[model samples]
Target: MKTLSFDGQRPCILQTASSVGKKEGEGNLTPFYDNIFQDAYLGEKSWEKAESKLLKTNLKTLLEKANESPENIDIVFGGDLLNQCISSNYGLLDFHIPFLGLYGACSTFVEGMILAAMAVHGNYAQKAIALTSSHFCSSERQFRFPLEYGGQRTPTSQWTVTGSGAALIAKGGEIEITHATIGRIIDYGISDINNMGAAMAPAAIETIRRHFQDRNLPNDYFDLVVTGDLGSVGKQITQQQLKNYGLDLEDRYIDCGDKIFDKEKQDAHAGGSGCGCCASVFSGWLYYLLRTGKCRRILLTATGALMSPTSSFQGESIPGIAHCISIERKTDNQ
Candidate 1:
């Protein structure tokens, strides 16, 4: 249970931008996104290439928003669901900034942000960009069925989100990165690829619990506690798990997956799941909330299932991990 409590000057969130596809743009937080393309391809030849464009456009948009250029970014931390994180690798190829690619499945955004914040806060860099992206077509081909297959999806299956988000972290700003909790991998023997919610709920619960314990804070310490891609099913499981632990999070808990689509009309059985799910939502809605004083503090626990097609085919259970970071509105209260 390793948790880091950041002290002194925390790295600041200077800017953030989210670029989502048509469906997500039509979702609950549509107004918060920086850009939305009606075409999933985004004028790219293939799905993977489209995803790469998503990242590129997102980072470019973030820089534009911050009134900076690629040269101002000391380094970039990014990842995607694609093998070897090729999407991030090639997406950022044109940039002159040093890149450190990472992979944490759906949790890649927070993983990158944590590392980027560390680099900036430790004085190793004056500024850094944290980015992650995912696409429906690309993720489907790699993780599950092909688009042409039209495979009948199980009711528990979640739709892969198509989007990307990038955030600029600098040495000073109004939004501070406060603390982080690095999760442990835990597998409860769930092998159903469609039921990722069930597979990942326990990991979210564990990480959230450990975070609270490590920080010696109660559930209400933060105005909001957000989870990545846990959808409705995983949300229920996590809520129940917290209840079992004598902690109730009903008031301030929100799952990014649950907010990405309308369950009644969208037919997104379990809701959304992908690296972009949390990335876009956080960059858009959550970032706005924090910046505008609607939320004073938030605990963002992005969860990821460390499983692959090979592992699933080999009858291996899906192991889950959750990474948490606290974001707060900077003030002179201290």
Candidate 2:
């Protein structure tokens, strides 16, 4: 949590995005469209529609299960890919809560969670809502070119997913954070976007080790250690490299990117990056464990390739940053 000033209250995730796969933050946007690629969100849609869908799906779930109306929430904390976070505009259409937009590129999920948690942990407020979503088409058109066009993608490129994910965190509620060790964003500016696995692993390794140091948390203290979306290559590098540092994340520390899609069938080179990659996976898989009591203490670290097409085109390298936050189930909630 970056507190340049005062933080009112740390927030807890009240909802887990939409709690559905191919659905996460996506509502009615899933059906077939004119183009298969377009159906996969090849181009940007209207902000009005995009934001509305995010709010409708995520907010609907929150209202249904939390036993609260949109009016009761203290604040709505979120942001999207647009300049002013355009998707958030429509998300605010129906909800009457105060809104705040945040941007950390693909790291937005952890960023929101970190901010929300800090605000709550610091005794700022009782509850706050944090959420983030990404559209494959909207991001592509805005950041690069339309996905429908046959644009040459560098090997390091990661496909953005057409999805949205939201989480609600409440303090003195059901779930509680016994300890939180925050990681500073570390970057290695490597130019080749085709090989993000190499660029990002170092940061994840360094940050996780720091997490162990900050909290004196042994490698086995957690049931599972999860990385945001470093695909297979990065995950391998992390698993192999961490051993050299006397830190063993092992199989228990898994990568969310590799689990999201069938890499062999999806042909996702090194798997997906972007916001939706982690968002959808966390909503679909992690939420399941939270509800079913499969595993309680989870350390999830999401990474972002902090480079744009413009940066790559300008002969700059890809810089990677990872944010580590520990989220555990609230035994008391039930």
Candidate 3:
């Protein structure tokens, strides 16, 4: 899937438990992970119920801020943590737009957005919204033990947050795609779930180097070059590795995982995880930065950990890949 790359519409901001603040500030919140799934332990309640609440809250916030209605939306491409995308399915039951369900692990946000933009650009749809979310409790219950269960996080681990993020992508609007460079999926099959940071770094560095090389774009072309979420370790490896390719991101490159939180002592080893780690923070701070002329151009490179039960059983290295896209502000006169 591809599209004419463009700047985002007015962005949306919704939080679950991220401890955002100053650089010297505390960091992302980690309290929710501790006792989140205890409610499930007590009852047979469906996962969609509580999650729908978070999704709806964020959706409503985005819709109201964008002055949009469900009927005005051409389609909603979404995904989340649950069997058959339960959160996305139940979350959009009320929106009434045609839905395209997607999954890219933590990279779901870009996958959805890219498809949605292509649909509108190709005249397949007039307008579409791409959204993705991840709740720490829901993920841990299925993937690992609850945090209150007192599991130790190795330095490579990431704390998933409980948040839903929505973006209202519009077509024939003030903003439009200006340039787009698609990336090939590069998987080394180095699958290690526990040590995700190192597993994901190679794919990220590969995609970033290729994207810049393919588009003939330099690191200074954009105000920031952002990655989906590689936690602290992956980010370091990516930066160092990118430099080897003669691409120095300098301080201009940042990680959504690290940026989502403003604090440091929250015990979140590296940073946040899940789809929301990138979607929500991008919709919030990045959007704010672009719309206000603070950031004129942005390069968002979302990475994925393509792991499966079968793959894990096969003891395959965590298959890692990354996709890259470039977005910038729309000039009034240009």
Candidate 4:
């Protein structure tokens, strides 16, 4: 039986690339992304197509950065917020690599990374690409009202990001994926569609706490700790929960959603929330920070709300999950 946390050989992170839309391009991590499309559609006919293009562009950039061809990738793990993860499925169709489609809502990127790392650690693959994406229009159309509806949004509502992030996992690299803590589903019976942050908070707290206990490590073990798409609400709640457990993250916690937009000026009510939320940040800004030696060891706990449009309409409460992965610099890996 698989335990809550597992230990294995570290897998290398050979290359990474982030490609984002115009809005994210203007955000704080603008300087970190490899490519930023001036047009959100990227010359595609529809918002969905735009999202597919974002993933395709992200993969192209990753391959270029690694100086490798499509055949070089042993396997591809990817996902998105779409109904069937059509964005990732269709985006890489031409590549013809063995693909494993996944869905963890906002946690898709980290989930993919965890699986990719596992494959490498087990010697199943020499190279794998872990990637994910999200688009505001695409997600909104599928999960909420139409984009043209102009419906008033609640303050708890979060803006879905429009972008993609990809990373090449291979043997012998400067960055190593060291550990993973798979989360169990937790539902606090939250039914509101707008308050995903609050709904996902408990799961994030549980996963972080479990990770600490499983590793027998203190809060200071990692130089940085981040969560996926939790925004302000989840971050605060998770922090309070951690305080109760005597695990104070203090200055180490970074909620990827909270850093994605200017809440006040940008009208992003609860900041960014989507699969791309952490993906773009990690592959772009956070990874850059790690490479620059600004931090040594980092724990990324990617949170996801497992409620679908059908589930929400059926009056089912949102169930949340969080998967954590430890990434470290070459020196720290030693």
Output the number of the TM-score-best candidate. 1
The local distance difference test score of each candidate is: 0.90, 0.64, 0.66, 0.88
lDDT of 2: 0.64
**Residue 207 Cα positional deviation in candidate 3, in Å, after optimal superposition:** 1.9
True-vs-predicted CA distance for residue 322, candidate 2, Å: 1.3
RMSD from true fold, candidate 2:
5.2
The residue-by-residue lDDT of candidate 1 on 1-334, one tens digit each, is: 4688668988989999999999998888889999999999999999989999998989889989999988878999999999999899889999878998898999889998899888988999999999999999999899887788957888888998998988899877999999888888888989999999899999899999998988788768889899999889999899888988977887799899998998888878899999999999999999999999999899999989899999999989989989999999988225
Off by over 4 Å in 1: none
Candidate 2 residues lying further than 4 Å off, grouped into runs, are 1-14, 19-52, 151-156, 330-334
| Model 4 worst lDDT run, 10 consecutive residues | 1-10
Clashes of each: 0, 22, 16, 0
Locate the minimum summed-lDDT window of 10 residues in model 1. Answer: 325-334
Each candidate structure's TM-score, on Cα atoms with residue i matched to residue i, is: 0.98, 0.82, 0.84, 0.97
In the range 70-93, model 3's lDDT, one tens digit per residue, is 787788788875667888888788
lDDT for model 1 comes to 0.90
- 1-334: candidate 2 lDDT, tens digit per residue: 3212212332345566442234222322222111112233222266335544644566566666677777766666677666567777776767777777877677777777777776766766466776776665567677777657986775455666555566677755444444454555566666676677677887778777777776676778777888877877889888888878888877787887666655555645666666766766676567667566787777777777777777878988777777777666666323
Better of 1 and 2 by TM-score: 1
